[model samples]
Target chain A: MLQAQYVDGRSTRVRTVSLSVSGTDLVITADDLQRAEPLAGVVFDEQLGNAPRRVRLADGAFCEVRDLDGLRALMASARLRDGWVDRAQRHLPWVLMSVVGCVALVAAGYRWGLPWGARMLAQRLPPAISAMLSRQTLKALDGGMLLPSQLDGARQASLRSQFQALRLPDGEPIRWTLLFRRSPALGANAFTLPDGTIVLLDDLVAQLDNDQQVMAVLAHELGHAQGRHGMQLLLRSSAVGAFLAFYLGDFSQLLAAAPAALAQARYSQSLEWQADEYGSAVMRANGMSPALLADALRLLSKSHHDAAGVSYLTSHPPTAERMRRLEELAQLRPVQPSH
Target chain B: MDQTTANAPQPTAAPARQPQPILFTGRGSEYFGIWIVNLLLTIVTLGIYSSWAKVRRLQYFYRHTELAGSTFDFHGRPLRMFYGRLIALGMLLIYSYSVRLHSLVTLLVLALLALVMPWLLRNSLRFRLYNTSWRGTRFHFRGTVAGAYRVFLLNGFLTMITLYIMAPFMHQRLKSYQHDNSWFGRTRCSFHAGAGRFYLVYLLVLAAIIGFFVVLSMAGVFNAFASINAAQHGGGRVDPSAIFRTMLITYGVAILFGVSIGPAFHALINNLVWNNTRIGEHRLECRMSPVKLAWITLTNLLLLVPTIGLFTPWAAVRLAKYQLESVRLLPASDLQEFVDAEPESPGAVGEEAATAFDFDISL
Candidate 1:
């Protein structure tokens, strides 16, 4: 135990003082040591006031007074140590626990909830109805319709050739149908309907500068189909629909109002990013540069230059940012194109 | 203090060292154990008093920890488990009553209300759960139950129009909203990922799995037919059950396909989320490879089939560890702090002189 004594009123003005310490630094304020004793081995100077009122105790331990000088020295020492460990320590535990805990909760939910949900859903349906719906839906959407005879013929031929080129994992050839529609209002729109029916509007065809870009866009849309994005989304919607219908009897009005409802919904940025990555990968696998997709976006943004506020495309992100991201991903080449 | 003052003139003190590794690893297993214990307590208490347990766990992990020379503490008290259960019970009663009435109007009202309750509870609980901060600063979570209702309506709407071509985007946005609205004191959090890469992988994997089963079914058919043909030709007793046997074979093939691929898909989705994590100033870097994820998934899938899916509980524990182990904190280096005091000046002259008269070391 080492000790040093100082009075509170030795200043010419005569006032009180207080002292505090943080970490290894002792801090003394201008109010401190005003009345302190000037004992033997204790040296004092007016010039030394500019420096910290440092004192050496009996055990040879030293401390800076709590005043501004003391705070400065303490802060300086902190800078030298690079106090991230101390700072990060507060967040470390909560973050780690939260991550682990969240995963655990979701896992638990999945374990008990998934099978229960699955069985419950399965039990509600007659196998006959399920099978019929599946087959009928597939046939209805699978490449059966197109507008304009000449355009239809060319697209059919292109699709036939493309489908034949694709091989399933079990070495079977893929069978598909392409549907085309002429829509003046929907400029350059294309999508795969829920049943694997790839629909390309005449407007979409008109905007393609090259076969590769067209193929890339088509491939990206096809990737969504092949990935069962349509299926999951439909299944989820169906669930929501069924729940709504069961609860509220006759949700036709709600179904009709869905587009307006969706217009107000905001998705997490990550989900948007995920879809972008998926689309780009699909484009890459089909032997098309994602840059072309980027170029396609640039064209769309330019075409819709006059659209008020943020359009759906703009809401996704700026075209330049999307393109840059796609290009960065494209650098990791030789990845499987289809998967 | 003297040594610091002597060497302080050189702004490039000690060659300007980098930040040191904090805690090596923040092992959360202890808190996880605490969570489990509290969860069990909640269950045992019939969901009545678990609020205390939740607060206990939160305080132990969050409030007691040190950050930036300040002790972080939760200012808001957590809700009791009993209250949570009561809410659940209330919702259940309303749902059952609506179903029993079987009327269009009642059902609609119940359905709309049922959808809104979860959103409401989430906001209220979050409001209570997350309050104040690392230093003297306060934390504010700018979210409301209405936002949750809006999300529900919006998700419903977009899903209808795009016919779900935009679903992945919707799901992503919901996740981002949850993350962003969550606060650490007052700092807003954000996250991102490579665009749509996993969606492609999902399709490929699904195609492969489906294709595998189809081939297996075809093989079964061929084998069964060949057996029947041989038995008939030999004038031997052909099992009258051969037709049924072939059907069984197809069913078996389908189940086998599910058992093999289910876990892999699960692992893939889990790994994707884990690998793509972003929070505050830290990015979660993952070390788990695709192969590792696939293996974990396969194991879980196999276990899932044998235990009639009961093994899922234990499997979740394993999955969580794998995911957690893969995550590493990558701190952002953009933050810089500035000090305002003059280099040559003594910082403590005026205040020390005023306090010189009071000398109470014992007190």
Candidate 2:
């Protein structure tokens, strides 16, 4: 017999009862009152860990059985679902494996899984949606911080026409529009909107010494637009945010936001690198040294004291490292071996 | 009235003052294993199993919380939560993109959310209380959607329009709405407190924080003055090591007190709400010390930093044990005398789960 506290379903009143299995019937005895009900009619709560199991009687009453051994004796192991989870939880080796497995899986998800998913999603999205998004985003930015270009109109025209001549990898003319903008806040920066609109700030155009340097910057923006890096970044971070919300939502309200922010910085840095490589390819295709971008970056960095972000947490990786990489790529081709 | 008083004989027995302390019978090591395993499954399944994880986590906490020899239990199923979570993810996507589409769209989303949040919260509360049971009887929430709107929306608007001066009033109203209509079996729990009490707690915490910053700034200014003067005379070059040291000290001080503020606020409100609440005729007493709670919270923070989030379960259990064990129910009458209220109120488990579009957002 399993000793338990029985409560009639209609009330909170409790009574000490002895429950026993007789044939296919479960017999319940409370004081002098006795009853037998089919054992199949009883409703058992799902067993979790070592929690006291409660069985609701057929007549709306319920029994809480705290006697672990007795309850286990009556019920078959197959009926006790989720027992494996409970057992694995208690096992030290299993727990250690879980810890290692969790870390590795999370790291892998961040490294490959999420990025791959975001790429697929970004590629499938319609161009019209990105155009609308870009329009609204540009409008919002203009309302806040961005200003009309202060650079001379003639210079803007020359740069635009030169950029117009640049061909895509498939030998097609670049389909994106180039706009000139000035921003005191975003000095010496060029960015691509999701809809392939490249915004070249006056600070960057003015800072570059030659046309090659300026074309290199524009090529970098073109890379971002062609690869749909902006859209991919948006999709990726949203996914990461949703995942983080699920994983750490209830547990670490205090610690959750920090990791998500760090991940964003990390993602953007990698995208920046991809855009740079595309810029290097364009530079080599045009018979301009990949080292022109390195020079442009150096000149821009010297003129513009870049203090916008910390070393590791910036959207772009360290400028020196990027410059060194471009220099290395330039060395591979040596400007022109015939020259 | 005088005739009625004279007709009934007064009972000679005084109300018993026996304090039945709440107990938590959960061990950290056992829970750590559970937490790690749940985390692993959640990651592997792309968060599909997160609902199950939440159920397990809640079951552990609920099952261990014992009051007067009766432990609480959660019957919330994971499938319902999984569906709800999927819907919630859709809404999250809309919310995330709305800001980029236009500011007006963002405003529209916020207004729309405010309009329906009360309704959603109402169902969420019902879903929560309806699933929690003790002694074969489930807890019920009698809070109306209208009541939720009044407390959450109307009061929220008023607080905002008043530039948040009425924040204390809103807090008090939220607490009242949460506690007053909550029913355990047939017995209704109630909480009564003025906004002034809330204001007092807020003001005290604010004052302490302000005082801390003021003192720190004063010390910082005095210390920096020497370095600044030296730099001005010493080729306009400040010692890099000196600056680094000063920054380190400032950050250390900030982190030390910053972690305590959240815990302090929660501890104060918990005590305030629990102490004033009455479950049936029994008065609930919670004697939680902000200092002690803050101490545990700080250590938890310190431990989590070192363990890199592995110590989550142990920290949670430690905090739960302290908070739960500090509460006691002062019995006013025989425990069995409190009968279930409204016999017509039944079948919440089957009825609600069938229509379970709501998720326990708190978890």
Candidate 3:
């Protein structure tokens, strides 16, 4: 017999009782063994640490037994259903393995899986949807940050014609449009919308030495558009946000916003490299020197420092590293004669 | 209502006036093992096991906390909690997506949430208290939705309108409502502190913070003026070491202010809350030292940052142990007389919504 406390569940009164196994039936009796109840269809609370095990019966009465061994024997004999989670929790080796495995899985997802998923999703999205998103974004930007192009009409026309003449190596011609804007706050910057709309700021146009350099910068923005970098970035960040919310239970708005801000501010180094490579390829195919892009970047960095203000490089790839890679590409491939 | 009535129970139980300190037997090392396992399982199950993990964590703390000879227990169901979390996550998704798509819809949702927050807070408290028990007798919350709005919302509005000068009064009102409605079995808890006391504590802390900033700015101006004078007299060159010293002094003052003010508020508030709280015929005593609590908090933060939060379980356990040790209960009657009186269970939706929105209603 196992000594225990019994609660009838109808009152707050606590009663002492003795519990015993009788063949297939578990019997609960008062201290005098004069009164008893047959424990059938009772649920046993899973053992947690050294806490007393509670056997809850159908009639709402519960028996709390402190004898761990006696409770285990009775539970085994009755063949009571126990949660698998309870069993797994006790297995130390399995728990350790699960922890290690989970960390590895999250690391793998962060390094590769999420970016690949974003790429696939970005590619599959309908062009019309992308165009609509771009239109909305451009409208918002125009309302707040951007102004109409400040360059002369003739210069704008010439640049437009020059850009139109350049062709990508691909058989299917890329669908694109160029717009000029003057944004003092976003000085010397160029960005591509989800659709093929490219916006080049007046500061960036003025920084370049010639039309070829301007073409080189446009080619880079075109690379972003063709690869759907903007959309991929958006998808990747939202996915990461969801993952973070799952890992860390909802705590603060600041924590939720932090990751999104980080994802937006800095693009992955690999994505920058890919876009650079595409820009170089497009320049070479169009019979322009890839070195023009490198020269433009060098001038922008110098002028940017002279201005003593935050510049386009705030969100772009590290200038020194990107310049070195561009210089290497310029050296590796001889520039084709300009058409 | 009078001193005589309040002192009646005390004189009758004068022989049993010896306070029993609350004990925390949980060890950091033991809790760390459980925490790591909970984290692992939560990740393995893709967060579905988090409800179970939460139960286990709460149970560990509850079982380890002892007063007299008996320990507390948590009886919250994992499945119910899981369902609540799912509902909360769904709501969050809808709210966030709506904010991006439609500003007007988002505004409406925010307004709705604000209106219902008091109801949610009340139910959340009821659910939490109902699930917690000590010595086989459940705790209960008797706060109503109307009471919640009056205390949390109406007082909150007054505080905002007063530019937060009435914040301490609002805090007092909320605490009074919570404590007065809380029960351990058949015995109701009461809070007995004046708004003036709360105001004094808040004002002292606020004044110290403001004084520190004012002093810092004055020093900054003095240093600038001195440096300008020195530069003009010394051939347009100021000593670099002087500038470095000024920067060092500024940083040291800032760190010192932060370290002092944060712990001061926590210690004062905690001591005030527990010391003034009376449950049935019992009263609580809190003896938490501001400096000691501050040191523990500061060290815990320093350790946590360097270890990249791996020491979180240890930090939590350490803090809990210290706080629990600082409290003692003065019983006016037999503890066994406390009976289970609450019969109705609160709806889990409000509790779940509060959890989902990360509302610290316990505060």
Per-candidate RMSD vs. true structure?
Answer: 28.1, 5.2, 5.5
Q: Which number leads on lDDT?
A: 2
Comparison by lDDT, 1 against 2, better one: 2
Steric overlap count per candidate = 69, 1, 0
Off by over 4 Å in 1: A1-339, B1-44, B47-81, B114-147, B160-165, B193-209, B229-277, B280-282, B287-316, B334-363
Winner by TM-score: 2
Query: Per-residue lDDT of A1-339 in model 2, one digit per residue for the tens?
Result: 789888766666677899887777778898866888787788776555566778877767788889977876766532533357766887899999999999999889889998898888888999988898889879988977689998788988898999998765556678999998888777677888988899988877777798889998888778899889888887877777767666554545557677777888788888888888888877776667778888888887776555452211134778899999999988876543221
The window of 10 residues in a row where model 1 chain A has the poorest summed lDDT is A43-52
Ranking by DockQ: 2, 3, 1
Query: What TM-score do all the candidates reach, one by one?
Result: 0.37, 0.88, 0.81
lDDT of 1: 0.47
Give lDDT per model, in order.
0.47, 0.78, 0.75
Interface root-mean-square deviation, each candidate: 18.8, 3.4, 6.0
Better of 2 and 3 by DockQ: 2
List model 1 lDDT by residue over A61-129, tens digit each: 223232544444434554432133222223446545544554475456434543345435544545454
